[model samples]
Target: MNITPKWWHDAVVYQIYPRSYCDSNNDGMGDLRGIISKLDYLKTLGVNVIWLSPVYQSPMDDNGYDISDYQDIAPMFGTMADMDELLAEAKQRDIRIIMDLVVNHTSDEHPWFKEARKSKDNPYRDYYIWRQPNEDGGVPDEMGSVFGGTAWEFDEQTGEYFLHIFSKRQPDLNWENPKVQEEVHKMMNWWIDKGIGGFRLDVIDLIGKEIDKKITGNGPRLHTLIQEMNRATFGDKDVLTVGETWDATPEIAKLYSNPARDEFSMVFQFEHISLTWQHGDKWSPIPLDLPALKRVLTKWQVELADEGWNSLFWNNHDLPRIVSKYGCEGEYRVPSAKMLATTLHMMKGTPYVFQGEEIGMTNVAFPSIDDYRDIETLNFYKVRTENGVSPEDQLAAIHVNSRDNARTPMQWDDSANGGFSDAQPWINVNPNYTHINVAQALDDPNSIFYHYQHLIALRKAMPVIVYGSFEPVFEDHPAVFGYVRANDDVRVLVLSNFTRESVTVDLPESLQAEQVECLISNYTAPSTLAQTVTLQPYESFAVVLPA
Candidate 1:
């Protein structure tokens, strides 16, 4: 908590999903050299850390999340030597690399799992969560895996069922076993020895959750396990471990950030991101709770500002693109995307950039449910269909909220395959490349890329954004969320209009200056009058205070 690592606290992390980021070889999948090719682009954007999704040796299940070999890169992604080159190149640019740590589970094909399944008495059997089948020889009851069916999959040879919180190919590790914990540490240290930074622990909250029962929705076990793992793996080594805790409450999330807890540097909670579903169930029709989101984030800010940092993100590889999710999707896409970015990055948290997010990439459409390859999205479709929802309706639901929305190939430019691949890409790139791509965005001064680059640079230069105390300014104002971030004499007021109508932001007479200048904005006007700031529909701006 005592100014741990200044770089990670305010660092900009750009996520590179290995398969879709860029492919140097003509094999049609992205590789490490491909990332090396773009180091200058990342350096130009002012990001200091690159968070790459799983490139470990794996079976194709869940993309690369299902690791079959912890120590090797998937041949499709490149070799160990290639990773070394990537680390060297990134280091030269002052960009540290953080790979995904998927130790919570491994591919069924993983040597550990293979040995475990071969015999119940194998030394590696305890590496996974294994249980006996029910009296009826059926898998034990549970809500089901995030992918589909029971969370348990049967192994005929071992005559036992193994828990798979995710896809069948991904078996959960038994962290309760000290030896398992040791092996995980060994793997983590292996990466550390490779000169890479730490990890963006995948589903780390769920990692701690117990295997005694299937999750009814979300439970407490996730919290406890992550703490134990952090103690074993990080333990004051100045590791940048961020747990992925979806559905974790603000109060519970604080525990991970509590310096006394030995949990993690930060944890990702799902309050702001969930606001988009506004009508989905546990997986669908949910309603947006803007006021609740404001309150939740505020609570975290108040509680953990000094003790821990927050992992602020708007998009990731496993969710719908932010532009179509929270921003005005139909007519006001550009303005709203910029506003949403303003609303998010301006807050008191470390910002994470998903691939192609700066250029306002959008959701890609799958012609049908089968066209969707993501396990969670496909599982949701099957569940809704079995619940008597029509196929058309089910597909309609996935179209809007599926995790597949975020997995499309990165659109680089107007090349034959969006410049991602000369050969066929694993997934189709969003066809909006003509309107949205790095090549075009970089050429235009007013493009989202320009805005994001400025945002990242400002964050690096200003301590107020990184170390300032946050206070929500207009909490009670309708369709408006405003906050003031200040550190000593440096003060900045960030105001955003979340609605489609212009809103008035009232400033206290004492705090209001005679005239204010727009430090940054997406609108045509350079600066508006300070007395009565007129925020256009979905407009946002950063105002440098008169200190």
Candidate 2:
């Protein structure tokens, strides 16, 4: 963008799931040292930021999300010295590091929670949410955890239930308590002073819940709490903050991300990604409603353009791979991935590239349930089976929608453990890694990796790609999606075929042939415009149009 460098506004963030990125110690788990070993690779990808998933000390109950110690590095990921070295190395390459901040809850193993459960009179009891059992000795509220069952966990010693919206090991923190907020702020400031760039707040919106009403998000004091958080911790620093607001509407998102307010630089909204699920349930798969997806995204693009900003992503540690969910992973894997990247990268926001996304990683179908490691997936399997869902059916759902799908180790080459580790990986590497690995992509000029490099380069070279206003085109079309982004000097048209079948669109008469200049495309086509144009399966093209 022509605007002064606000780093976050124009930067591409590459997310690394520490357990799956690479294993430097041959322990089969990715670590801070593994990330340090790949700094040059990130530099080559042209991404200016790296968002590492939680490396904080944890019990691994919910992977790294259950933080036992926010200040200490998790032994599985490596030492604090390793993290310091990683930060220095990344900075040397002009890449900023954004850490995953899981403050909504802490592991029960945390000193605060450990003491809180000892007795009702314990000094640390107020650090967590504990409630007396209901009249019927049931949960204190009607809310269900995101992982299923009641959101309340009964602690035998205290004879009170603690709220955990995730796993029981992860008890929600009492943000209403000033002491808790102070502890969170102190920890954040310590990280900032340690030279960390920013934070990706985990389940940030859920932190402000009303116990009586059982509302998990957009609670009464959510905005006030975030505002105070900013003023206390990150307000003075030049840092990036992104909150994971799973159920946030556009209006709610604006509140968290508006620049006028000292909350966050942007928020990750889940509306578009949740389109294919029935009744907002990830396990319930249905046909993807393309028009609805476009509508939700367009609303965010329009509503957040002025006051707030958006965090663009298709895959993350908690979701399935992009190609498997939205694109054809079997026959049209390469082109489909490039198409997905072009669509998201060309949007009006900061784009995030999840680990292995650039090289076209696809989801895995582990032959048996034992192959899965994610607690969420395993929990779903147990619950679904008890509810009479057939084993085959449960496996089908997990294969298509498990978070583990995105947790597979990064495939660097075709060698053993996909060159990720000399030992067997914590999770099996996708067998397709032999062909879809980064080494193969680097050697092949037309690989998805190169396409992503081109896309990142275009964002850096063209200001319009970063600052242009977005307007949806062919909003009602099912198989083909199109949009235009324009600035004072240039307007760019992005068109993609979302299906494996050829699709055609009637070009608007306003798009003159003389003004069209090809910028990027997954497949070669004539630059000249026609009244109607056909797109091959999974083809995507972007062109500079007359402004």
TM-score of 1: 0.94
| Reference-based lDDT, each prediction | 0.79, 0.90
Q: In model 1, which range of ten residues has the least summed lDDT?
A: 209-218
What would the TM-scores of all predictions be? 0.94, 0.98
lDDT of 1 by residue, 259-291 (tens): 778777787887667665554353554545567
RMSD of 2: 1.5
Show where candidate 1 strays beyond 4 Å: 1-5, 213-232, 278-283, 286-289, 524-529
Alpha-carbon error at 195 in model 2, in Å? 0.9
Which 10 consecutive positions of candidate 2 have the poorest summed lDDT? 1-10
lDDT of 1: 0.79
lDDT of 2 by residue, 1-547 (tens): 1233477888999999999999999999998888898899989999999999999999899988999999899998999999899999998999999999999999999999999999999999999998999899988878788888888999999899999999999999999999999999999999999999999999899878888876779899988999999999998899999999988888888888877777999999998888888897788878787788788888889888777888999999889999999998988999999999999999989999999999999999999999999998999899989999999988998988899999999999999989999988999988888888999999999999999999999999998888889999999998888899998899888998998999988989876465478888999945777888899999999998765
Error of 1 at 4 (Å): 4.9
